[model samples]
Target: MTEQGGTCAIPGDHHDTAACEHISRMLARISDKWTLLVVRTLGNGPRRFNALRREVGEISQKMLASTLRDLEENGFVSRTVTPVTPPQVEYALTPLGKEFLCPVRGLAEWVVANAERIDAARASYAERRAGE
Candidate 1:
């Protein structure tokens, strides 16, 4: 690793230091628990705020709003408003966000496949630590 523009970047990689930083920041955002859940929930289809909240579960209103705002600002999600009685608002994934789901789903599948091995490894590690 090399320090470039105060961010740690891999040397000799195709990506420039700025590109590495951008990727790191985006990874942090999408890898967030709420962000992942929200994105997965939105993957099904567009949803109203309350419906999204209900589906996401255990997320506070403020956190969900903040996550949606960040996703929107980052162009991963789109917000639409209809001029109805109460002006219905909906949130859905953009093309980029839809593309992102590929890796996310892959990661989820990897976790499911490795869960038993992971649990056994963790148990062994805990046993060794306790003996220490």
Candidate 2:
């Protein structure tokens, strides 16, 4: 119930408005612009902070740091600081995080595969909204 997209005990044992609200917030965090990309990239392997920044496309430093910290807090990532050198640091997916990689990648693939149709749907919705 913490942050995973699962049922909630709030209100009742059965699905409730509180569960829906929890789901919405969880999606907001996981599907965040940087979080999604960061998880995808980290799925490949552990990476240094700068390496992650470069690989995740266009993410600001502060946003990336915050997202990584969030991911770490959510048990999706592990952060380690090497004692050697000028204090090297790296991040990798925990077992739990790895469990979600396939699903996230599949969602991304679905978007790519249906981009045209999805875009058309969005444009139609926008046009309908404008006319309303």
Instruction: Give each model's clash number.
Output: 0, 0
TM-score of each predicted structure versus truth = 0.87, 0.78
Cα lDDT of model 1 overall? 0.89
Candidate 1: residue pairs that collide: none
For residues 1-132, what per-residue lDDT tens digits would candidate 1 score against the true structure? Answer: 455554445555644767887878878888998998898889899999999999999999999999999999999899999999999999999999899878878887899999999999999999999999
> Which candidate wins on lDDT?
1
Instruction: Single out the weakest 10-residue window by summed lDDT for candidate 1.
Output: 1-10
Per-residue lDDT value at 115 in model 2? 100
TM-score, predicted candidate 1 vs. hidden true structure: 0.87
Provide the clash count, candidate 1: 0
Off by over 4 Å in 1: 1-11
